[model samples]
Target: MSNRSRPDSAGSPRGSDEAAQGPGVSAGTAPVGTVLVVLHQARSTPGRIGARLQRRGYGLDVRRPALGEDLPQTLDGHCGVVVFGGPMSANDPHPFLREETVLLERALARSVPTLGVCLGAQLMARALGARVDGHREGVCEIGYYPLEATPAGAALLPWPDHVYHWHSEGFDLPEGAELLATGRTFPHQAFRYGMNGYGLQFHPEVTREMMAAWTERGAHRLTHPGAQPAEAHFSGFDRHDGAVCRWLDAFLDAWLAAAPLK
Candidate 1:
């Protein structure tokens, strides 16, 4: 069956079904195959990533473990999974964080098409026995930063020169993972584990509304060394958003096509 025509499974929650249908889907249409979406905050939306998945005829099964929602024991009922960025660090001692780490481990082991962004990326790295920590110099990448795709990355897809970022910590390239992209401040910008698991330190999923919300709500983070001013964030978005959007579209297509590791 086509991805859109597949019936919704038990993995997808009722609220997520409505959210995924949005205005494009007919009221009586059968729900699509679900992509498990893990968010850190209660109000966190998957932003452009969620929209892209819906456009591809995949429904989102959003769950916020931080707010006490349980993650699935397995990814069998889902076509893919995405863990979005948040203010929390992957190194935190929270039980939910540990649970997410375990879930990521399972995703990778099953060779499920999985994506982890920012803290999600860090968590993936941590699950793979890599370190997730801040720069010793105390620098932050709270704005657009240049991204240099590695040879392996360029072979897979074109990458944006500058990408949106909103994190204080970065992850080390995990063992057995191929480094896909790099940046000066945080050298390990993106990596891939096996055939189906990917991690991105930048926020390609952020929308204009999400960017505004982040800059305003995370205003204090702008004061940190290496962070751009709020005005720069808007100006940078205007300058580079088109490339990022195009890159995200191509990347998602490639991501979904990835085969399970043999």
Candidate 2:
């Protein structure tokens, strides 16, 4: 798969070459701390989230533990952690998954700023001793769906009416975790474990190009019981993407502000 186009801070399309460079230090300034980005696939990039972090002046230290890349034993020198979603389940017996869960556990223990998306969210829930499993009816959420912010979530920030989803499984809200957002099929859309840790089941990081690629390559997923038609995905993007992007910007700001770099 080709590297998906991402938007720069100015909202212009950035080429794959530029995106491939990842986040780096600006010309003369000493670096703001780095955020450890954990991705599951070889070709996977952090998409909008990485770009947002770069614009905020934090360098990205991208790691793919699935491909034998080793994660740091600690979050030393790291300001935050973002674990992106993937095809693998958090319940899988893969050693890398176990390693990541352990790392997430440690990060939470240290009160490190952490954001988990989709499978990443599931991993966070697992680390907190919550169960991650498929729906009893076997329904999946493969496209855009309605999202309602709970009273607790609305107090933090406004949310988009609908958000993109692509998962067969959902996680139970772990003990002590606050449910931030909700959906029909997957009730637990977003949650906060502590002041610094967040888990979102939807993909606010998805860009238009990423959506196109996902729909094409994973077309079969649309046939699932609760999945949306491929065309609806594009329509949903046109109608809801602006709100989602705004929400992401606000959320990232709040997330970083929640914990000062240690």
Q: Per-residue alpha-carbon lDDT of model 1 for 1-262, expressed as tens digits?
A: 0001111110122234223335433456654677899987655677777877877777778899978999998788887889877667788788998999999998888788889988889889999999988888987787899999999999999999999887778899999999999999999999999988999999887667666666666676678788889899999999999999999999988887785211
The sequence of per-residue lDDT tens digits that candidate 2 reaches over residues 1-262 is 1111111111113454224245556778765778999987756778888888877778889899988999998788798999988887788889999999999999999899999999899999999999998889988888899999999999999999999888888899999999999999889999998899999999888888777767777776678788888899999999999999999999999898889653
Which residue window of length 10 is worst by lDDT in model 2? 1-10
Q: Report the alpha-carbon TM-score of model 2 versus the true structure.
A: 0.91
Cα RMSD for candidate 2?
4.9
Total clashing pairs for each candidate: 0, 0
Scanning candidate 1 in windows of ten residues, the lowest lDDT window is: 1-10
Residue 107 accuracy (lDDT) in model 1: 86
lDDT, candidate 2, equals 0.83
